[model samples]
Target chain A: MTVNVLLLLVIAVTFGAGITLLLERSLTRIVVGTLLVGNAVNLVFLVASGAAGRAPIVDPDDPSPMSDPLPQALVLTAIVITLGVAGFLLAMAYRSQQLQGDDEVQDDIEDTLIMALAERDEASQSWEDDTGGEPDEEGADR
Target chain B: MTTHSAMSFLIPLPVVLSLLGAGICLALGHNARAQRVVGIVTLSVVVAIAAVLLAGAYRDGPQVVHVGGWPARLGIVLVADSLSALLLLTSAIVTLCVLVYSVGQGIVEFGPDTPLSVFYPTFLVLSAGVSNAFLSGDLFNLYVGFEVLLAASYVLITLGGTGPRVRAGSTYVVVSVLSSVVFLVALAGVYAATGTVNMADLSEKLQAVPSDVRTVLQLLLLTAFCIKAAVFPLSAWLPDSYPTAPAPVTAVFAGLLTKVGVYAIIRVQTILFPENHLTTLLLWGAAATMVIGILGAVAQSDIKRMLSFTLISHIGFMIFGIALASHLGLASAIFYTVHHITIQTTLFLVAGLIEIRGGSTALERLGGLAKAAPFLALMFFLPAMNLAGIPPLSGYFGKVGLAEAGIAAGGWLAYLVVAASIVTSLLTLYAIAKTWNRAFWRPPDPETAPPIGDWHPSTPETPQPTGDWPPSRSSPTGTKSGEPWAPTLTAVRQLPAAMVGPTVALVALSTAITLVAGPLFGIASRAATELGERTPYVTAVLEDGSGITR
Candidate 1:
């Protein structure tokens, strides 16, 4: 029971810290955060595999507990995938730094402007609806 | 083996052939000629195989193949039903066209950052990934498929290693990785709850789980898939990142990639969780995606960015149909998916041609293209009109079918989405028309015209006339290669037949959708009916009596 509790707590802390880092603007921090989150998820899979004990080799008469090997296999695959992605992330970061000398992701100009326009459109439409489609009257009141 | 047994080979052939093709393409290295020939020939064979698979699936229900002769419960299974086969065929066609188009763009080399050899291999791998995802019968396998494609896309999107491409590439990679993580978390949860990731097994096991737990799992999966599908709030990365890639890369990405996510969503809702517990959530999402996506499109001055936004909007149409969770809704959505893929790809290709001729995709600096290149003008006009749901086009047939489905559904939300559908359609027309009047119809004003210099194609064989245009200014590397707001200096250079021919072929494919809408709709309905039943797929894979187990 204590082991399970400890594992759960470790997963929580790791995932929380990882996600916090990912939300930061620095590209290096983001890459580290991805690694951390990936490890945290691996730990979760470990915990889900039940009480760990031994390698999952079976003997005909063995009566001892064996760790569920499935999650370990899953964790191994996950780790490899994370490594591949981390390499890609590092390459992308290097290229980004080379180009702009910084790792901050800039907001797309068109995206922000379009989103703002959408908000304005929504506000105006509501106003027209509130004024029973009399937009001139609504504008005058404003 | 009899014909029935032989047909199972078709399920994995496309993916395997494409992978083999990628290997050969890679070995060809900088030999651009060999790579193009290999890509075209390999994809053509894949297309033929896909057509056969589609016909076989339609005639004989879903066909299941287990790799290495293993049991469905223990091994990866590839299932070819009407849905996946249809997608496979459509995507194969689009990718082949885009490959030929890229070859025409003098895309043989791009300095040290991106080599032409890398493009074909990566593209083929991406196609293989897409096919794998569509045909996967299990969740973990599906996740693998997503990673394969996402990794290939990372390479393709940042092909030139230019500044904007890198920036956009990073954002794309981050978003995709985050979604993959979400999918992983959901996969863990699903496995913990039910102890299996085989979707057919989950279909049976999920019912036994507590309702609250099942709902949580369902929502988690939906959230992950939604990010990938670029539905609404999660879609900001799409319009930002997609417009940065080379034109052919962008074209194929817009056409086929998101539809893979939608395919997964349909599989999730129908095969794994058929209760429709999330219908209301999906409806609200559909309405928001449509309205917001088109609104974003309206605000974009750049042609590629506008098309990207519109791409997001039309995904809503598919989601809208899926939200209805009815036969007609699913059928119409399938039809729309096919129509949208062809039209969207053609539009992006045309956008590429326009950029080639005019030197920029910005409407502000482009004019007199109608007079300059009337062929390009007609090409743009048809797809734009088709996309806006103009009559006698595939888009119109798709929209009418969807509207009918919505009315048949007959709820306040359905009515609202139907109305939104109409509004978004008109808005799409308005936006496309705005582009047309500015870029094509209007006369070239000197204020917006680019400086006149002796311009030539940017290939080595076509020698650059000595120093008329500054070499630094004329180097075509980045998305904004030319002066940001300037038009081309000379009359448009003659586009290679390789490029224009594919564009014309794709546009005709879009029109061909209308020519065969009746039979196509029939096929879609049959697919829909088969999907709604669900038992055929589930049993073909899982039931011991089916003899699929090794």
Candidate 2:
């Protein structure tokens, strides 16, 4: 089995772009990234199937050259899985947009506090909020 | 059950039974009682089967069942080793308890045909997924198992489709989807490097592969599992997402889910990558995960969020045991895994009771629970102390076992890890004590007492005429405080026996673990020994020359 440089380059570029999109703040970009990464993974499986030749059919006497069927099966399963998760991600993004007018996940209050403390390099302090303990009404409304 | 005939049938029974139960429960969605019965009965049967499988595997070594009567390495196989059987049993018990707890919560449907009606079925499917992952004999099959459970979890996590749940669900889904993608990529890499995805075959082939490639493959698999496991660095998503769900949902997720990832890591590290190339990395990661996780726990004012953080921290202890790569270490890890699962689930269940009784799990809004419901306080206290590694409890035993293993390893890093684990344990005690002081022991001050009607079903709109505190459920919404803490007892009396029963039973179960620590540790040691040896599993699955297909 020989590695195909052209397919390798394509797979690398696709993965890189997909990861970059995943890191972006926009939910739409993340969804797109997921799809791209999904496709790139499929490509990796395809490349792993060895140099493409025949449709992987089993026959006793007619064996000239046939591609490995396992990677194709793996790719097919991956595609289906990606589709399932991608559809869910898209629906989530759409719902967020409809409700909040933006598709970004706001960091939790505690998460923000942790980040601030880390940046400040402060010792662990009591985080007891004195705002009279009620659930975050703003969060509940949103 | 000791015979091969019984073993084979029992080995796959839990997964198959759970899936069938899920299907049946889904079909009976409109009838809530029927759904509840199906879920409970199915889980109980699974628990029984798991117990038998555990005993059987212990007696006869690993048991394998091939699907469709196909030969091994070609068809999906489910193997019930002592380790898997132990995991299956623990998970089944936790799932059953949580199911009862959810049933007690009164099965509120958000709409006529909402997903809440399907919660029973989804929960069963999640259990099936977990069982499948534990029993799977192949990497690809394990991935399938992970997806199965994950899909069910996605449905369960967003059961009410409330605003907070949906938001949390979205973050959870995105993170989970990314991890699955990474897992797929890793599977491809494994198959590419070693021509098979069947774990038994790969374990043999992987040994012959080059060192660098093997390390990469191992690390890739570890990354996927780590994200699922919520180890530090990849653990940011856990605390944010776990707290918003309904009580039973959160409880089950806390107990059984991350342990599945830890199980997978133990599987790969012991059976496949026996060379221990990444022990140092694992140790460092464990230390950070423990320390950082506990710090996050200490920082949280909310009970559920704090438990979630501690959950991550304790996972570090398990990783430490696995890192040692010794018989005693793995055994201790196994024991600790079982102990933590029970303690964590029990703690969360108690927290749920707190939410039910006190109207909130936020420590700032909660007080005087010990006076209101001493039973609930006692339930919380046992698991809380156990989790903090208090002596004479299972948690103490597990921690001692881990520390002994660390000292036996006799390295500076190991010593550092031991010291960190001890500190984390003490800090965990401090965190739990702080929670107890605020939520239970302290008297409810009239000035700061949470207003009434926060949880009363009659008034979804904020309470009326509660003096100074804001009527808004959100604290910042109102500029006041009042005398509502007195009426909390009325809600406490309304607590359903069904909800309280399951929690009491689970706490009793954890106490039973402590009582029977001797025999339990023996089982853990045997399982760890068998896992360390590795050949028993290879032989059990690949007997009769059912080696690599390629």
Candidate 3:
């Protein structure tokens, strides 16, 4: 029921930067953004575990409370899963670069075609109408 | 008591068996025959396990098992209710058939004798992930299940490392990873708010959180899942990525992946947040998903991309049922989910067959398919109509049930959604008919025409695979000079019997749903009742102490 100001600020900073990087067209940058965002979430889980406390173990010398161990377990699992996904994305990015000379995300063939079709449809009633046949349009897909 | 205990023992077998099967297959990587046998046997056993779990669940309410005999409050518990059990069986059947189809079609990118073919192992892992997700009784485990499947899918989607696939695979991997990050954030929020990630526990505890904070949590969870589900605003990734994969991969993904998201949505909405606070927003999303998705389909010139769009569009119908938040609505949604999974998969499989016979899935590049291969035509025609929700099909029955639920809800938004759904169905029919006309009914394009003026598959002999895939668009053989085109019928390499058999079996399974619609709907409603009421699951997991006490 309590909010930690410092932790909140840190979470906001990291999450904000992650979202910004995520918008880039480069797949590597996107993967970096995903990793940062993942770390920020782990930090959120840390904040959720509450103020730091004595180690959660059997102890006779001290009566300090034990910090919640569940969130720590959750964070560990999250980190491992994020690592595996990051590895896969890196492999894909490397493959992309090797094949196309760059790791930048390419525009979709169908999406570009759909946009062109939309433009032509808008000019359907105009005197300067421009339209093409299926074979030519499909050629544009490649 | 005995039945409950016995059922609990069997609940985790699907996930455990699948993971074990995956490890076995991976070890047998160099041996193709051994890998195939292990993969199919593993899935077959899992199917039997799911069927047994389904019957046990029906006979004796929900079954629960706590891992390592740990207390329900402390450890993960896997639960098998009618809802999860039914989906598990359907998915297992579909996965097996797709595996058979994939092997038959030969997705062996590095030739048949490559030292390491990653296909079977990756597929088994994907099934295990799906099984885990369906049976997970907690939010964190659910997230893990999603990650596992997404990871396996990342490998499957880019199998060949070819230019188009790698490019498409990049977009897909990034988007899916983003969704997983969002899901992780939601898990953090749930743990922070409720202090436990278990669903039955959360169901009781989430109600106590402040309404504003609770709304934030629900919206975060919904956002992550809707992205996975490919809801309207977030759906642009799906059509772009799906069509680029090999055919069998596309078929399996079309069948199972998004439905996992739908299953999550249904679980969370029905169990964790019983009050349905975001009904209006969900209805709006459902309406938009249906309209825009089918609109994209109508605009597509390629068969694979067109089917991908319709896949997104049909997700709307399930969301409509979920948004209604009534017994009948949820039941109809479950029924529709099952129907969509089977039929969409069938359609994609047929699209693969189309690629083999015509050398391309583009409507303009294909024609005279009906004359060329009658069985493949029938395969495509049946699923297309069924998808359009024509009367007498399971799809039609599901839509009617959803519409009835919408009317019963009787709000203007509900009415608008119903109207939108009807419009979407008509648009689906239009798009499908357009594809049929161009791809099957009309004569083969003049340039790629058969040499004997016309030809059929059964005439004397057939031909072979001439690198027709990603069909070679640069060469128009006969059109260059005045030389007539050659007649090449490779069985479409005269449509391979092994591949065609599975596709036909899936199509027949879809028709079988129409025949058995009454009982399936009955089971669906009973499951819905358990879901809507919420006591059966909670009691089985937290209250009844079903887990063995060490």
- lDDT (CA) for every model shown? 0.81, 0.82, 0.83
- C-alpha-based local distance difference test score of model 2: 0.82
User: What is model 1's C-alpha RMSD?
Assistant: 6.1
Task: Give a tens-digit lDDT track for model 1, residues A14-114.
Answer: 99999998888777898999999999989878766767776789887888898877667777888898999889888878878887898777777656665
Best by DockQ: 3
List DockQ for all candidates: 0.29, 0.30, 0.44
- Interface RMSD, all candidates in order, equals 6.5, 6.2, 5.6
lDDT of 3 by residue, B321-408 (tens): 9999999999999999999999999999999888766756776567778877888999999989999999999999999999999999
Q: Where is model 2 chain B poorest over a 10-residue stretch in terms of lDDT?
A: B467-476
Candidate 1: clashing pairs of residues: none
TM-score against native, each model: 0.90, 0.91, 0.91
Candidate 1 docking band? acceptable
Per-residue lDDT of model 1, residues B1-550, tens digit only? 1235788878889889999999999998757678878999999999999999999999988888877677777777788889989988999999999988877665422322233657789999999999899889989889889988998998888875766777788789888988988888888888788877888888988999888888898888988899999998788889889997778889999998898888898899888889854878888888899999998887777799989999999999999999999999999999999999999999999998887777667776677788778889999999999999999999999999999999999989999999999999988987797678667866665554543332224422221232111111123332333432234423335455778999999999999899999988988888899789989888777762245542
lDDT of 2 by residue, B223-267 (tens): 999999999899988988888877788899999889999999999
Q: What is residue A58's positional error in candidate 3, in angstroms? A: 3.4
The superposed Cα distance between candidate 2 and the true structure at residue B436, in angstroms, equals 0.3
Between candidates 2 and 3, the one scoring higher on lDDT is 3
